[model samples]
Target: MKLDVELPNPQNLTEEFEWTFPVGTVNENGDAVITSTDKSPAKVKFKDVIGSQRVTLKTKLGGRTLQESVFNVQVAYNKEVKTVYFAAKGGNIMAVKVDKNKTPEMTIKPYDMGVKSGQHPFNIFFNDSSLYVLDCGRQFTYINDETTQNMGDGKISVISYDGKKVETMLTNVGGYAFYDPFYGYLNAAEKKLYFSDRVSGFAAISLDARNQTMSRSNFPYFVQSNRLGYYGKTMMYTSLNSAFEFVDGTWWWAKINSPTGVFRFTNADILSKEATAADPEPAAGVVFKNLVIKSFVVDVNAALVHVVENSSNALYSVPLDDTILKAIAKVDDIKTYKIADLPIKAEGTSAEPVSITQLILDKETGYVYFGLCSDDETLYKSGLYQYDPVTKTLTPIVEGMGVYGVAINNAKSKLF
Candidate 1:
């Protein structure tokens, strides 16, 4: 079908037209398709793209869009859009459809999105219909080997909302990706991404540019082990399993081997000092100790931090307030969910172990989603599940699949 829009006023009869539509609404070949000025009445011949797509038509003069020309057009489709995306083996990103009225369905064989070889697409973030994937490439394959060439070959890539465009923002990226994707965290407030890399203890990537050209040189180190005010000065490098930056600008992190607690630090207290070796940060402190947090997400509204404890292999809600956390609240008092009752192997397999990664929050619904790897069955079967913290209800969505990374498209605070 062709969508045509005639010039309303027709002031400049010879003026050209620019067409802007949803990612899928105007795809041409394969995936790289957007923006066109080819037809007379600002016409667009739709292809496989079908949906209630919002189409915008702009009239151009002198090769530029007219003052304020914007149009709205909606095309209906057969099914609701996809909501859940995860990376399985082979570096392919698959999609799972979760509609209110329909049964959950997932793509088979070939995936919806593709990434480069040797990548473990662990974390996927959705903002403004785009996905930011953190691929811990070769980080695990050569684990424990300091001389491995590709040990620091991880990367970060961005994909179009429709899974058409895949672009890598950086390479040679290293992270503490053991079995889960909690190797890094994104802070929408500051428009920056913080992740633990092998090269730097903790590096921050600024998302100001459409595409960043940050090499190991432009390393935005957040909390270097050697930085003046940093706490863990004795360690040469860090293997961060869980990390988060609160809206208040406080940084929180927990290492892979650390069963003590989550460490906390402020930017001003750590960055002001020059980075050296074996020098501890005087201001560094542990917010909450004795809880080995494997993977976690913050529920700002509830003021709780839901974490998957490594030792117990259970889900628990802890007070989000750092002030109260430091006051020595007993870990047993907080509520614990039932989903983590299974044996999730966050370790290597006999020859190669499976990583039971994924703990995310759908803020809009106040529900938390997570993944479990098991050979057993239950009301909440293996795969991925959605938990409602309010009513303590657990609904299993995707079952029987080895889920590597799970990212929901429920990002209310989008930076893009």
Candidate 2:
């Protein structure tokens, strides 16, 4: 005799299961009898079948098959994989799942931070669980025949990975007069956010303090008393356009304009008492002069700093050993420094020179990634490129989009 059976679709197999059978006639004793070949009509235990399983149920009477059915089961763990997040100019933050091949498997939807026109995401940094985004909000107009001023309303916001919550940590941070908040670094050890604000000078925000404030005092390298008597007398503050990196217990950064070169300051210097009008200047840290450093990345494990010179569109490497670092610290003024022979060139051609906007280093892989763009907006040459230090090869990864910022999630082994 034929019997009917039903099964679930792609059963989870993690929870309990129940099965119902059709009622049948009873014997003279007035008791219905039923039997299952594989424990049907009962709670199914999947302790032995975890990944994937094929189950079959059969009923037989007097060695004759009554009914048979088969079903498939899959067991999976409910968790989110690690992801890397990045953003481009006038674009929202996009996340990609970490993969072994170092290529994005898929692109997630744009993360909305509630920014309006004349405001966009400039940079992004990820901590253990949250993301820090710098939103540049400003409008520029010519003050007179020669000068222009920026009316500002910028902010720094922290967002959760799930895109469910957003918290504005700081607001009205200055950066629009020159460049936006182009680069930022998170010092987990010090619990501070160091970012490059061209207008207000390099600034830092204390993560541990209850009040969210950005101050130039946090950056001791810049001389706040230096005066510029052009148009009117104004204090000449340092303009930083690169991300800061911590190497060998010291913080290293580079400037975009005058006194342009790589510099470093000890943690003690950053944590020291703020400078006062009487003092005016903090203890000058080590300065490497005669180099126009637009952006740089430090590979602590390799003991080298890869630098990008904006003017020449060239790439150079500098040693980070104590011998060089000590020589710099001892000098009263900016000292001449030496750079190793060029390993890779960023210059494109005589007609159109490629401008390296940002640089990111992957210490684990010894690969340097850079974002390239040109002065002409009509040209579509702007894109992302990768340089393998070991092989000394520069290869284009993606094209069409002008990448302003790039970051890697080391813990997740993902690149953005």
Candidate 3:
């Protein structure tokens, strides 16, 4: 099937296009706009709807009936996979498998983790043995173990597998204080669990593999940073104002110009003593640059990174050397996309608390998925997506999940 891929305009902040698909095909039209308060899904219209925001096609991939699809899309992957997992809207875990040609087949595990509200899955962590899922605001539970635990204040649970049940370990970092904005921003990486408190700065909890106890370390001055990934012995992250590289030796910082701008910082002047490194030259002397960071991981496998400013989704890539210390060049793709144009809401709904703002990549599959809402238009009720790089395509593999949370897991294969 032929798909029309519309790229967004960086400058205008709004771009629209029109393309015709084959007969008997239907695309999500930008023309019909509705609000949650609307009475009916069929009615409602917008004047200057550019074009259909999503690409739709007729496929026998995993559809039981014309409208009933077995494959519920949560995210897309650039690389091919034998099987993929998504948290379903109806509180189940879906496994999507397709042959070489992308013909989807499916099976679902209806093990409930007590997620009653929200639009997206609480959070799913794939480990060596089983899938560890956190039902946001509900309870943290695992499929294999059938054990559920309540998250204590200032603590988030991390699951580790031991060939049997998924073990739940708690980190001592404060949750409400770290993620004041979005509750789902808690994630695990490089043996460290990172999270931000609502009123406080960022915190990293080191997971001791030997004893399995989580150690807490407060990030001196940084607050509300986005997880960029781990490189070497350091952890990378971004905030609205700046980017940071944290290592045991020192804390490095860089002023961030945009949200989607790929950044590399040389803490050529990072000093632990100073309150703000950007402050004037000290009376005694100068500070030594402590950290030299190269590339930040928006998508670890694909090496995709960006620092977006405003809602103007202008994507940029910072090509870096092996050390991620210097940027070779900042490359911009000819194509662009407006986050507003993406078809995120269900068939008829208004924008709500659950809307997608960030994209995360599955290192195992090279798929780029965004944090979405229960409804596409709502930013608060969040879910996840997997985007295919080859097709330049976006598909919703999971839905009815909750708001912005950190999702990081690398596994050998699906448990089922």
Candidate 4:
């Protein structure tokens, strides 16, 4: 079923959009809300809405409930096996078997091999029978053949699913200490592990699956955010608000108000588009400058555009094809006019509804999901939201108490 959703004003997202929905027998409000519960099978309240069917799920079976936790959660799956995985609160990774007849749900278990407890399950990966988790700790933890009392050595834990054993890799990358929020990528084709800090520099650590040894190499560029992707033989890096591709062993980086930096690594010459090429500083600058960027996410397929909000409280995209950048390259800019806009306006909602949280996107289907909240403290107030861009629709896939995280393995017929 298609549900029309309005974009909060780009200038003011805090202001709620006055949109409503109606279904066969129920009336519902478009805004997000949270609920508190006292039972394991928690209770959720869908308050202030018109029609109930307007908030119903389109899937065949399975029910929704709130995820109770403070930290971010991640879900993984092996499409071939039709199984789903998730790291829930209290550092437990659970696997739920999916079949044609059962409801979409999960049961918890201890992997018993986490590199360290209390590590944020913010990042999860399933590559060839191994799970690579980025445990972003404020301080480093000790990880070696022995357990030590030194409680502060930031590290990445590599766990093998076969035996559920973990080993620490790469203590220091590029002379700086390690921190949480690591963007990890292992090239299945090349057998290489790439690492980068969401708030700072970039580097790579080569892993030998046989013995699990880490070798670090200093790669250039300061990445300001966490959203990045890899496809083909090329790895794309988003710096500040703009993005560049590392393909064919060459780095081609471009943006306005900053040097259009390019390097071949093999060659010593570092060329700046600003030094040799007179590039005009575009009005909608590439960088957010001094504004405090609150939240940002990239549409996996839309490489040139990203969704970001600055301290100015404005949501905008940094188009790689901005006129100024294209003018310097003496090529036609490829950016098309924006076809749609998000309906968020103002700031600081009355109890901090589910609408306040950032929407997580499914790369395969372009569906964005996020939970609703009634207030800052009661986080798991509502269930899951799936927004389809094609129909400009929003579907409340799951509903219950406030949920900590939302994960969908559509390929495996499961949601966690």
Provide TM-scores for the models: 0.64, 0.55, 0.43, 0.42
Q: Compose the digit string of candidate 3's lDDT tens values, residues 185-257.
A: 2233455434333222345544433222222343333332222221111222322222233432333333222
Clashing pairs in 1: 51-75, 52-75, 229-281, 230-281, 260-290, 348-353, 349-352, 349-353
Error of 1 at 203 (Å): 1.9
Q: Which 10-residue window in model 2 sums to the lowest lDDT?
A: 223-232
Best by TM-score: 1
lDDT for model 4 comes to 0.34
lDDT scores in order: 0.55, 0.48, 0.33, 0.34
True-structure lDDT of candidate 3: 0.33
Best by lDDT: 1
Question: Distance (Å) between predicted and true CA of 51, model 4?
Answer: 29
Q: Which residue runs of candidate 2 sit more than 4 Å off their true CA positions?
A: 1-83, 97-122, 138-150, 173-182, 199-203, 206-242, 267-288, 321-357, 374-380, 413-416
Off by over 4 Å in 3: 1-154, 160-168, 171-190, 208-270, 276-303, 306-340, 343-358, 374-383, 399-416
Q: Name the candidate, 2 or 4, with the larger lDDT value.
A: 2
Q: Which ranges of candidate 4 are over 4 A from the true structure?
A: 1-90, 94-117, 139-152, 160-181, 198-200, 207-363, 368-387, 393-416
